[model samples]
Target: MLAKVLLLCCACAAALAAPGVYDAVGYAAPAYAAPAYAHAIAAPAVAHYAAPAYAAPVVKAVAAPVVHAEPIDPNPAYSFSYGVSDPHTGDQKDAAETLQNGVVHGSYSLVEPDGHLRRVTYTADKINGFNAVVERTGAAHGAAVAVAPVAKVVAPAPVAVAAPVARYTLPVAGHPWG
Candidate 1:
């Protein structure tokens, strides 16, 4: 057994001392030197596409039969305002406009997503920055409202009646216990 173990150890040592697999296939150190390891990554190159320059279309003006038409007034007599409502949350926006002696008076209201309402009433003009009043009204978010408790009116207690007594005497037959 000792001789067999010694032979096995010698064989393993000889195999390990031989040349590696890469050397046997002629794949020794590369002819060109390898580059050093870099810690930082290189920035990637990107190209952005833009629309090509376009020439404006030429509009050919036509000479029509000369006709005189009424000129348009820049400023109108009446004032008007409109607003759009949000569909998903059931919120609404509203505005009203009125011309008061050439001054524009407008009132605006916006219903918020959380059921709160905001209002602004303003006298707006180019000369003066909007003179406005703002108001907000609604229950605060996540705030609970207190409810008053109702007083309980208990009905009167029912009267108790006495149970009927049964009386029937048995005829004859003496016994130790009744």
Candidate 2:
């Protein structure tokens, strides 16, 4: 009788353990007991993915230098014109003064006959600054030529003046003139 009682208890325990054994084998549990089964299983290990490697950059070829055929000018002449105006008042007062004084102020440069370059400066206050041309002749000297175009003036015809009007009046009944 004791052996039969022990066998009956073992049978009851086996019946209770059957559902958990089926769950461990991935069998679907009842909806109400799903949370308990999910908590019992171990999660899968996370994947460790890596990025792809890049190759080294390549260098491009360089182009060759260019060369010219013709010989360049060793002592070429350079010419330019510039006007001077009052910096404070923005008027060309110096130009009028230069015309009245017949003098000009400027700088010049030249290449000497012996291949040496020389520069000279001059200031002529009374000279007009109109149509002035400068030429770099050689390394020694430069020339300035003024070629202002002359303008002709025509006089207008004279107009006649009108005579003044005269006025006379009679003396009133006062003292001597009456």
Candidate 3:
């Protein structure tokens, strides 16, 4: 706490100075007896501290350098195709694919809500793994028409009228709230 208020203000300025106060060893603390000139005054050589010399820091060891990375392409080649004819939900479809060195050809088609046209075709590698083959063409045209999703008209936010303050009403002759 502020060193006890600076040691109570140096003990109230050494008790308002002067009462034979040469303390800390220069002994003249009288205020009573032994004031015989306090032994001719001469006691100031007590300094014994000694603690300031530094040097302890050294470390070294390094060895790190070995990197080799550049080899990727495990039969990686690609090709892609996509299609989507969504006449508001009539939702047609289409797809295509290809990978080279590892075989993976593909095909896709849709539109089969009694509207036929469902072609599919596929293939994979590692010596024949997957293979698809579905084909439906035309032939049922009489029940696919339910489109209805196009309505977004939001226009109604323009209103800020506040400009009419004319004044001229001096025809008073019996007004109650004219």
Reference-based lDDT, residue 48, model 2:
33
How do the residues 1-178 of candidate 3 rate in per-residue lDDT, one tens digit apiece?
9999999999989875854343533554433233356468554444443334467787777778888898998779999999999889888998999999999999999988878899899988889899888888888789767889999999999999999999988875987777
Question: lDDT (0-100) at residue 118 of candidate 1?
Answer: 92
If the candidates were sorted by their lDDT against the true structure, best first, what order would they fall in? 3, 1, 2
Best by lDDT: 3
Question: Which of the two candidates, 1 or 2, achieves a greater TM-score against the reference?
Answer: 1
- The alpha-carbon lDDT assigned to residue 96 of candidate 1 equals 88
Worst 10 residues of 3 by lDDT: 24-33
Give the least accurate 10-residue stretch of model 1, judged by summed lDDT: 43-52
**Cα lDDT listed for each candidate:** 0.74, 0.51, 0.79
The TM-score values for the models, in the order shown, are: 0.35, 0.17, 0.29
Stretches off by above 4 angstroms in model 3 are: 1-42, 46-51, 55-67, 74-98, 102-104, 112-114, 118-136, 141-178
State, as a TM-score between 0 and 1, how close model 1 is to the true structure.
0.35
Error of 3 at 19 (Å): 32
Instruction: Give lDDT tens digits, candidate 1, residues 1-178.
Output: 9999999999988886664534444444324434455765554343333344579999999999999888976665686888887688676898888876557888989876566789999897777867999999987565455669999999999999999999999898988796
Candidate closer to the true structure by TM-score (higher is better), 2 or 3: 3
- What does candidate 2's lDDT look like per residue over 51-80, in tens digits? 334678998898887787898765444334
Q: Name the runs in model 1 displaced over 4 angstroms.
A: 1-64, 67-69, 72-75, 81-88, 141-178
